[model samples]
Target: MRDLLAITKAIADESRLRAVGLLDGRELCLCQIVEVLGLAPSTVSRHMAILGQARLVESRKQGRWAYFRLTEDDAPAEVHDALAMVLASLKRDKQAKADQKTLKAVLKIEPEELCRRQSDCKC
Candidate 1:
């Protein structure tokens, strides 16, 4: 029960919540999350830690890149329902809406520049 409450508390922050919503289904690299969350890699990493401890998200490491994705493990059924409702309603959120705008803007970079800019820091 303590762990459950702690996990929920960790994800309870609006920023962390937004981060989860951003990567709900899609796998996302740290750089992309940085671009979307507008938060530093360190901060994002902490969010991921809490989320992972809660079993709400999973991480994948490939070479220098680490991708994060939503998971369906260990959470109460309510968490799943909450996530589903959030995903369905999330599109209407101002933060998510703004995040999409930023991502689209980022897509215009050249290949080398994108790689350099994207860097795949695996945050």
Candidate 2:
């Protein structure tokens, strides 16, 4: 019951759901997701945390960067089904389409460059 509740709560928000959609089949660095969603890095981190708790996403830290991807292959059936539902329902959503378009450009920028740009850093 707790797992179900967490999964439902994790995907309850539009931002989180969109984040999941963006991660359907690709791994993304935190900065890339921040760029696509136009949200603060901290905010996106919180969203990722929730999704992680729900077993909907997985993360790996390499140095200072964190990469996230949708949980698959080993995720519970419910998690997979929920994600499928989200992807199917939002396939034609205007916002989702816009995000994907923006994501193409976002993906072109290397992760380190994206982080530097986000932080307005010269390094």
Q: Which candidate has the top score in lDDT? A: 2
Q: What digit string (tens of lDDT, one per residue) describes model 1 on residues 1-123?
A: 765575667567787777777786677776676667777667778888887776777888877666788876667775676567666777889888887677667645433353465444432
Which parts of model 1 have CA positions greater than 4 angstroms off?
Answer: 73-78, 105-115, 118-123
lDDT of the structure predicted as candidate 2: 0.88
| Best prediction by TM-score | 2
The true-structure Cα RMSD of candidate 1 reads: 3.3
lDDT of 2 by residue, 1-123 (tens): 888899999989999989998997899999999999888888899999999999999999888889999997898888888888888988978999999999999998998888877764221
Supply candidate 2's per-residue lDDT for 91: 92
**Local error of candidate 2 at residue 105 (angstroms):** 0.4
Clashes (N, CA, C under 3 Å) per candidate: 0, 0
Candidate 1's displacement at residue 117, Å, is: 3.9
